[model samples]
Target: MNEYFIDTNIFMYAAGKPHEFKEPCVSLLSRIQSGELKAAIDTEVFLEILYRYHHINLPDKGADLAWSMMDLGLNVLPVTKKDIEISLYFYQQYQDRGVLPRDIIHAATMVQNGLETIVSVDKHFDIIEEVKRIAPSDLI
Candidate 1:
């Protein structure tokens, strides 16, 4: 019953073409679907997945994927004003350390929700001491 914040890369890998991480990502997602694990994603993460799908000329697929994530019972956390404020602080604190703005927002979302574990392949999450990033393969 552990709750984990899911990052954008995890969804992208689960929905993308075959790759080394695909299988593990798929497995982790399947677990979520089966109610074996609890997972949540911020609005930014959902938008990132949708944008990537559309960017690749698959807008319909993007919509379907978004619906599917909802169907799988993924909790979609809102990006609140507080999250934005924290994101700004994170941005100023980690920008020079190579963390992107979106990554900062993701970290802020997790922090705001009291989530300390994130399922992501992105090493940038590691820069935030409040988050523990785990690759899908590590879970598998």
Candidate 2:
């Protein structure tokens, strides 16, 4: 119950410049940094960080951030073939209600990993009954 599946937005918001969410996100990250909080992220989140940095024309920064995620000592879950198979089911169920394919994958990973809670700002995750979405602010 104390562990959480960290979402891409938490990293993105914490890395980007000032924003409404930056403070809470950073605070949550700090907790993670100190080993006071437990967290994990799927490999897709690693690639998404790379893609986002590439999309922003900051490939170097992206690489650094991706590496830093590994350095954070958080559990970086691999996306196994079985996880993708699970995603197919969640996608079919939640796609029409605003859940994206990547999120479905995240949800599937949660199910496979026995993680019932996620730390994220995405409201769409609320539609998935297998996991609960906790905002970074809420946890801090």
Choose the strongest candidate by TM-score.
2
* Model 2 lDDT-worst window of ten: 64-73
lDDT at 41, model 2: 96
Record all residue pairs in model 1 with backbone atoms less than 3 Å apart, i.e. clashing: none
Per residue, candidate 1 scores C-alpha lDDT tens digits across 82-110 of 99999999899999999999888889998
- TM-score, model 1 to reference: 0.95
Tens-place lDDT digits, model 2, residues 12-129: 8988899999999999988998898999999999889999899989999999888878767688899999999999999998889989999999999999999999999999999998
